[model samples]
Each structure stands twice: as C-alpha cells, then as structure tokens.
Target chain A: GESVGLHLPTLSVQEGDNSIINCAYSNSASDYFIWYKQESGKGPQFIIDIRSNMDKRQGQRVTVLLNKTVKHLSLQIAATQPGDSAVYFCAETGGGATNKLIFGTGTLLAVQP
Target chain B: GAGVSQSPRYKVAKRGQDVALRCDPISGHVSLFWYQQALGQGPEFLTYFQNEAQLDKSGLPSDRFFAERPEGSVSTLKIQRTQQEDSAVYLCASSLAGAWRTEAFFGQGTRLTVV
Candidate 1:
C-alpha cells in the first residue's frame, strides 16, 4: 500500500500571499521526503526536504513539515510570487541503497497577480 | 561548479527506433540519478548510480531500458525500440555524497518524442 499523493490537484493564490501545498504518503518506511518545483519544459528543482527523524525543516522562503503519524507532508511558501507558479511534487526516497525517489501526483500552483 | 547537463535537448524517433540520451553530471558528484517525466506528470525514478557502480535499477520499466555510468561521472540512458508511450522528458540529477548533506542538482532534461 505504498503510495504518494497530493491533497490538491491544483491551487491558485494571489501574489504576495502565502501558499501551502499538502501531500500524503502511505509508505511508513520512507525516511527522506523532498518537495520539488517543476516549471513547464523544465526538470523538477529541489525546494525543501525533511528526514523521518525530524518533523520540520526550513529553507530560504520555504518550509517543509512532516507528520509521520498521518503520513502527511506540507510545504509552505512565504510571500508567494508570480514566478513561483509551477507544478509542485512531493517525493519520498527510502527503502533501499539506490534511494530512488517515489513522486506524488503533483499540485499545479498558479500564482495570480 | 556548473549544474548537471543533458544532451540532445530534443529528440524525435520512430516507434521502432532506438535512442540514446546522455547526461553530464556535476564535477566530482558521486551519485547520479535518472528520471522520466511524462507530460503533466511528476518525474518517475528510472535508475541510480553510485560512483561507477549501479547500486539499484529496480525502477527501470523494462529490459529495453539500459543505463550506464562506467566512469562514475557521465551517464547515458538508452531505450531500445522506442514506443509512443516512451515520449517524455528525461531528467538527470547529481548529488555529492559525503559528510556534508546537500540537495540534488537537476539538468534541464532531454525531451524525447516518439512518434
């Protein structure tokens, strides 16, 4: 029953506002989770990541929260800008030596100016 | 150092044709990864390489998909007898594995269109 999913398929918010993207994963053994932002015709870029040992991690203008009990992960973007518009994905890397990443469905975040 | 680089930014091939995509990871990076991104979809892991050894390749869809990082630096993904369903953007990522943990750097990607 290992699966990764996004809570919302799409999200829209006004510029300068805060945006929260949520994800749910069923793999309890997963130890590392990362959020990536992918623009059109581009590769997914790393945003933030959290280890299973920790519940939260923060990066420049971005924060990631992990809740192992509910298998939930969330990314909070502070002062969302129009340039932040892209498809956000949650990927889990664990369970083996390869540390292959298992991706979620994704949420297309559209920043409206 | 510069970011990861993937060649053949765009490639079009017939259904039965075979195609090779190249990836030049960041200098000194010991971990290499390959992923495929379909239109409107997230990147799916295809394989991973540590140094010159491919530690895992369970994500490879089929035997037709072959990947190699002989020198532990540059890598290549070859798809034999391409199919229409194989069309997507191939991404390569590199990470420095050591005491200092860091994020993986991605390449622009190679978009392969199979007709």
Candidate 2:
C-alpha cells in the first residue's frame, strides 16, 4: 500500500523564524506533489507544488523541495508569521488514470509571537 | 461561484439515518474530487469525477457511500444508514483540467457529525 507520512506531528517556531516540515512518501511513481495549508474550520489550501522533473520550487514566501532518491518532501516557510500557523499536509499523485491525490498525516505548525 | 462551494457547512445526523452532501464546483472546471478528513488528520480521497463521468471511486469507504455528478457541475454524496464512524469533514475540490499537473482548488468543506 502507498502511504505518505510526516516526520513530525507538530512544529513550533518563533514568528520571525523559519520553519521546515518534512514528509516521506512510499510511492516512487508519484510524479506530482503539493503542499497545502489548512486553518481551523477551513479546507486545505494549496500553497506550492512541484513535479518530479523539478527538485525545487519556490513560491512567494514558501519553498518545496522534492528528493526522489529518498522519496522525501519538505516545505520551508521564511519569516513565519502568526497567520501561517496551521496544519500543513503533503500530497502526492501519480500519472495514473485517476490521478487522485494521496495525503499524509498533517504537521501542525504553531507560530509563537 | 468564485470557488468550490459546499452546502450545509455543518450537519448533524443520528445513527442509521441518511444524509446527502452537495458540492458546487467552479464553473468550467472539468475535474471534481471528494475527500474525507478526520480530526487532526489529512484529507483522504473519496471519489473523483471528470465531466459527469466517474473516473475513479475506489477510495469510497463502503457501499453505504454514493456520489453522483449528473450534469458534470454539481455533485452529491449520499450516505445511507450512517454510522458514528462516518463523522468527518467532507471536502470538495475542482481543477481546471483533469490532468495530474493541474492544481485543484478546495471548498470550505462540510462537517458531518453522526451521533
């Protein structure tokens, strides 16, 4: 069975500091990966995504690093803010016909001001 | 309208009851997906629809769960004889294309509580 799991259940960081969340996926066939942020009582919001062809992708204040050799994915947030406090989930999808996403257990990020 | 919309932000149902959750995807979107999320857990795939065609429903939990996208825009997920274990948040997402490379936008989600 394919599974995606986070290295940490929760991560606490200072508001002005940087935060890094790690994820491990078992499916090497997964070509598309996405990082999503979910606040309380809200749905998973897409933050950044990277294809297997690329090792790193950067957004406004976020970055996603994909390591195919180790089947590891990481999300890095710069200058973490209170508003960035939420549960972060990493999802993966392959090039199958369905292309349904497989999500990992989320990592709660708490920003301490 | 602007994004994926789900009706009944919260639902409370007694055991053995039936419930239906609705999802209105963004206009012109070709792909619609349904996921279930438990407390403190990531969303799990339930089903997926592409232009009224159910491409994949292997993620459906059991036979009690049924989803339909009649016209390819609005979808309904119906649960029969619901159980306490069915309590969770039902999320709907839509993407412009059905390909894996496209990004999907999610709705606020409907919280289902079975007592």
Candidate 3:
C-alpha cells in the first residue's frame, strides 16, 4: 500500500536554530505536496506547498524541498521559536480531479529556549 | 465565513449511538473534504466532494460512515453505531477550486468521543 511517513517522530531544536523535518512517500504519481502545522487543540494550518514541477519552494521563515528521485520531502524552519513548536505533517495529493490528500504520521517539533 | 467552521466543537456519544458532524465551508468554495484524526496521528482522508457531487468516498472506513454536501456548501458527516475506535477529531476543509494545485483551508474540527 502507498504510504507517506516521517523519518523522525520528534525533533527538538534550540531557539534561534534551524530545524529540519523529513518525510518519505511511496507514491510516484503524487504531484502536489503540502506542509501543515497543527498546534494543540487546533486544526492543521497550512505552512507551505510545492508542486512536482518545482523542487523547492520558500515562504516566510520556512522552506520546502522535494527530491523526486528519493521520494523524500523536507520542511526547513529558520530561527525556530517557541511558537513554532507543534506537530508537523506532510501530505500529498495524486493531482487528480478529486485531489484528496494522504497524510503521514506527524513529527513533533519542540523548541527549547 | 472567514474560514471553514465546524459545529459542536466537542461531542460525547455513547457506544452504538449515531452522531452527525457539521461543516460550513468558505463562501463560494468549490471543493469540500472530510478527514479523521486519531490521537497523536495526522489527519486521514475520509471523503471528498466537488460542488454538490461526491467525487470520492473510497477512504470511508466503513458503511457506518456517511457524508453529504447537498448544496455544495455546508456538509455533514454521520457515524452510525459509533464505536470507541470512532473517537477522533473530524476535520473539514474546502478549497477555492477543485484544481489539484489549489490550497485547502481547514476548520478547527469537531472532536468526537465515543464512550
């Protein structure tokens, strides 16, 4: 079965440091990927997204990198802060008409001051 | 209104009971989606609708689970004979368009507890 999974279950980072969260997906047909941040008692907030045509995309203080060859994706956060602490999820869509997202187990990001 | 909204932020249902979760998408949004999130796990796709038409329902766990978006706006997810395993947060999301590249906005979700 096709699955999207994280390389690390949790990632602890010092404040002001950079944080990297990684994900591995099995579906080659998946063309759209998104990174979402979910805080306690809240819905998953969209952080950034990338299409298959592009290998990387950047947003405010965050970046998403995609490696089609390795079926790997990563989210990079610069200057990690306490507010950035949350469970991060990587989701993919087959780019079909339905465009239903398949999510992976999340990675808890803890920022230490 | 501003974003996707779910009703009854918290729900407690007895085993074998039925529960209905509601979702109100943003105005004029063309796509609606339902997902189930278990404790400490990411949200899993449940069903999807394009406008008033149900486009995909393969992710529905079983026949006991059903969803509807009759007007292509407000949607509902109903669980029949709820089980303990059915306890989770039900999230609803909507996108401006049904395109594959569109971003989906999510609601805070309705937390369902089956006891």
Candidate 4:
C-alpha cells in the first residue's frame, strides 16, 4: 500500500526557534504535496502545498521543500510561536486513481515559551 | 456559507449502534470529501463525491460505513453497528472542481465516541 510517513513523531522547540518537520513518502507518482496544521479539537488547516515540478514553495511563515530523488518532503517554520504548536501532517495527492490525499502519521510540534 | 460545516459537533454512541454524520459544503462547490481522524494521527481518506456522483469510496474502512451526497450538496456519513475502534473525528472538506489544483477547505469535524 502507498503511504506517507513522518521522520519524527514529536518535536519540541522554543518559541523563537526555527522548526523543521520531515516526511517520507513511498509514492513517487505523487505530483502534489501539502502540509497541514491541526490544533487541538480542530480540523487540519492547509498551510502550504507544492507540486512535483517545484522543489520549494514558500508561504507567509512556512516553506515546503520537496526532494523527489529521495521521496522526502519537509516543512520549515520560521520563528516558531506558541500558537504554532500543533500536530503537523504531510499529505500527498495525485498518486492514486481518486484525487484523495495520503496523509502521514502527524508530527506533534510543541512550542515552549 | 463561509466554509465546510458539519453537524452534531460531537456524538456519543454505544457499541453496535448506528450513527449518521452530516456535512454542508460551501455553496457551488463541486467536490466533497470525508476523512476519519484518530487520536495522534492524521486524517484518513474515507469517501469522495463529485456533484452527487460518488467518484470513489475505496478508502472506506468497511461495509458498515456508508456515505451519500444526494443532490450534489449536503452529504452524510453513516456508520452502522459501530465498534470501539470506530471512535474518531469525521471531517468534511470541499473544493472547487473547476480549479486547477485541489485545495480542500475543511470543516471543524464531528467527534464520534463509541463506548
């Protein structure tokens, strides 16, 4: 079965530090990659997405870097804040027949102030 | 109206009971999706509907989980004979089919607890 997996289950960082979460996907056919943030008792919110053609995409405070050769994806958060603490998930789309996304086992990011 | 909306923000059902979850997508949206999220895990794909036509439902866990998007608008996810493992949050998302990319807008989600 095709699946996406995260390198770390949890990451703890200081409020002002930079945070980097990594994901490894098994499907190379996945053309679309997305990063989502989920707070407690809330649904996953779309943060940033990158197509296979692009190796890097930047949002307001986050950046998604894709490495197709290694099937690795990463989300980088700059100047992490307390409000940025949440479970971050990396999902891949366009791999399967259906336009559904394959999500990874989220990485919980704890920003300690 | 603004984004995807799900009813019965929380649900508590006894084992073997049947439950129905509702989702109201944004007006004029053409794609709707349902996902199940377990504790400490990301949302798992469940089913998808494109303008009332069920394009795919391969991600449904079992036959007991049924979803319908009648009239190509409001959708429902029904779980029959629910088990303890069925306890999770059901999320509904919608996207514009005409768009080039599939960027889903998710609802708050319905938390189902099977005891």
Query: For this target, which candidate reaches the highest DockQ against the unseen true structure?
Result: 3
Candidate 2 deviant stretches above 4 angstroms: A1-8
TM-score of chain B of each: 0.95, 0.98, 0.98, 0.96
Query: Which residue pairs in candidate 3 have backbone atoms (N, alpha carbon, C) closer than 3 angstroms, thus clashing?
Result: none
Model 4 misplaced regions, further than 4 Å? A1-8, B98-100
> Residue-wise lDDT of candidate 3 within B1-115, one digit each (tens)?
5989999899999999999999999999999999999898889999999999998999899999999998888999999999999999999999988865778999999999999
C-alpha TM-score for every candidate: 0.92, 0.95, 0.95, 0.93
Question: In angstroms, how far off is B72's CA in candidate 4?
Answer: 0.6
lDDT of each: 0.87, 0.91, 0.91, 0.89
Every model: Cα RMSD to truth: 3.8, 3.6, 3.6, 3.8
CAPRI classification of candidate 2: medium
Q: What is the DockQ of each candidate?
A: 0.43, 0.51, 0.52, 0.46
- Residue pairs in candidate 4 whose N, alpha carbon or C atoms collide under 3 angstroms: none
Chain A TM-score values for every predicted structure, listed in order: 0.90, 0.90, 0.91, 0.90
Which regions in candidate 3 have their CA more than 4 angstroms from the true location?
A1-8
Interface RMSD, one decimal, each candidate? 3.8, 2.9, 3.0, 3.4
Query: What is the C-alpha lDDT profile of model 4 across B1-115, one tens digit per residue?
Result: 6989999999999999999999999999898999998877778999999899988898899999999998999999999999999999999999887324677889999999999
